[model samples]
Target: MKSTLAILAMAISVPSMAIAQTPPPYQPGMGDLMVTIVQPRHLKLGLAGQARNWDYADYAQHELEESLEAVEKHIPKWRNLDIAALMAATVKQPLEAIEKAVKAKNAAAFDASFKQLTDACNACHQSSNLPAIVIKVPDASAFPNQEFRVTRP
Candidate 1:
């Protein structure tokens, strides 16, 4: 009888212990996503363009664009600011211009468009009361593990 009671108590407590041990799902903030995904891709794209690695630049540009889209989708409204509208007004044209420059493989055009994109990013930050978050062209490669130079087949 005592063994039966012990078994019942253990079975009842097991589920509670499991529940207590389980962690909550991770929820990343807007800044977290930007720093982790968008910023790195933007830097890499700039590096690829500066290196005249058109193929890699094309891939990196698309990745950056997709990251922006994901950010807008995930956080349509942040702190009462409409992220989608802000992105459309500020970044859409610059991103399109960058895409055109990438497709044409025009380094000068890419540089101009990239500057526009960076300016738009800063503008958005300023408008959002985050003037301290200023983005610029990377002077050096942050990723030493990956090569920005194009490899000929």
Candidate 2:
């Protein structure tokens, strides 16, 4: 009878120990999410456009747009400013223009739209009092592990 009680206590305590060992859910800050998701996608999109890799450009552009949307969704307000409204006012048209360029597979238009998009991002930063956070055309791929070139059949 004592052995049965000991075994039951052990079983209950084991579950409690396991639960205590589990880590808490990860909740990334706005800056963390932006750096991890949006910034890389933006750079890749520019590189893909520069390479004239239209297929990859289209995919990268979509990923960038999605990242921005996710950012706004997760952080609707940052430092008491309305992020969603800011994004809509500054980025919506430029993103649409970029999407148009991507669909048409026009590298020149993509370049122009991408410039507008970059400017919009900077404009948002400025409005948010983060003038030092400037975004620009990527001169080089920060990602050396991934290929941005078009794969010709």
Candidate 3:
């Protein structure tokens, strides 16, 4: 009777012990998801906006925002960087202006806002000690067969 009880207890306790163990949280030092994902998306969105490809710009904006959110969700704090807030301070104004222009369908306003967004991208890169990664308004179409001209709907 005691042997049977001991076996049963061992079985229950063994599974419980296995279940209790968990992998440690990921803690990469730098050049993590923020750089690998978030930063590039930000630069691309700015370039798309500058080209006045509203449809593509909107998509890029959504992608950039989602990437930023994902970075924050996966790794909320990195190297003591208030990553979300830092990103906000750099991009918020330009993003808001772009949203307003996009709503109004004002080409002039969109152009100006796009420039601001590009500048912000550079600013952030410089602030992050990544000045080598310069961003600018695209001069020539890089994506072939894709329209960047202002278009309806």
Best by lDDT: 1
TM-score of 3: 0.60
Q: After superposition, how far is residue 117 of candidate 1 from its true place, in Å?
A: 0.5
- Write down the TM-score of every candidate: 0.90, 0.85, 0.60
What's the candidate order when arranged by decreasing TM-score? 1, 2, 3
TM-score of the candidate numbered 1? Answer: 0.90
Model 3 poorest ten-residue lDDT run = 140-149
Candidate 3, pairs of clashing residues: none
Better of 1 and 2 by TM-score: 1
Number of residue pairs clashing in candidate 3, backbone atoms closer than 3 angstroms, sequence gap of 3 or more or interchain:
0
Residue-level lDDT of model 2, residues 87-119, one tens digit each, is: 998988998998899899888899999999999
Question: What lDDT does model 3 reach?
Answer: 0.71
Please give, for residues 28-77, the per-residue lDDT of candidate 1 as tens digits: 78999989998999899999999989899999989999999999999899
Q: Which runs of model 1 end up more than 4 angstroms from their true locations?
A: 1-6
Candidate 2 accuracy as TM-score = 0.85
Clashing pairs in 1: none
